[model samples]
Target: MAKRGEALRAAHLRYAPRKTGSGALHCFVLDCSASMLARGQLALAKGLLIALFDRARGERVEVALICFGGARAELRFGPAVPRWWNERWIEPVGAGGGTPLEAGLARASQLLERAARRDPGRARHLWLFSDGRTTQFPARPAHADHVTVVDCEASALRLGRCRALAQAWDGACIDADAMLA
Candidate 1:
């Protein structure tokens, strides 16, 4: 107004752009193979998920869920805020058939890629909850800024696939049981 020194018009009025802080997105990949149903690992995982979702809600982070089993992988939720997340939503996700680890990872990769393109400034984190029962090894998603592999393999004779994956991807590896504690 001072520079113009005249009647202000809509074209002359300048407003500074507001800055919204970069947000975060968390994508969780869960292995729902029949193996997970053994020893109640799936149930435990669901419990952990509830806890994690609560934490994400408190932090105001967006979340997505992908479950893999029965020769396929499905996106159970969205990359949006889980406002009404609850046990009822997770209860119907039953386990069966083979562990299609590669399929699950590929789906997550696609989702992360789309999210990155939509909001390049948003930070992306990938969480994998698996029993490591699969022989397939998938590449890490490029769009994920951080990755965490939750090793759910509770068998006495461990295969150590999840640890191997974490090491290969240079990501963090955490035990499922330890996470509950």
Candidate 2:
């Protein structure tokens, strides 16, 4: 009894409150197509990525990055914590080739579905940063709890594809220019 009482010291009694956003996951689908390179869209997208990462870091949520361009979609980051995240890490992600929108969404869907199978209670949010240059209007990721489409198109003649997709998916569509301001 004396030893048990000694173990309950103030030094070992640190209060740890349960955080509401603890199990939340944020999946970022970045479009690194050649279209994104035009009008500095890729640059803007990269800036937004940094900000979003910072926000995720502040909330202590897990994040995954999937970049699509040229011929394929690649998982650039993780469905893990952004502990050592930095702007320089995204510097080598060059933009070129066709926009593989379908491939990117498919990859993200696979990841989210797997995550769902692992933890059904975990909240998954998908953030798609794209110029909406592709002709393919793929299906929305059902595994994702929420979705946000950031339209990076800055051309004079807007196609409004991203906005339409966001509406169809019942998600938010934010303009890239407005996000920066």
Compared with the true structure, what per-residue lDDT tens digits does model 2 show for residues 60-125?
Answer: 889999999999999999998898777789888889999999999999999999888877778999
Q: What's the TM for model 2? A: 0.87
- Cα deviation in Å at residue 81, candidate 1? 0.7
In candidate 1, the residue pairs with backbone N, CA or C atoms under 3 Å apart (3 or more residues apart, or in different chains) clash, namely none
Q: Kindly give the number of clashing pairs for every candidate.
A: 0, 0
Runs off by more than 4 Å, candidate 2: 1-21
Q: What is the C-alpha RMSD of each candidate to the true structure, in Å?
A: 2.8, 6.1
Q: CA shift at 41, candidate 1, in angstroms? A: 1.0
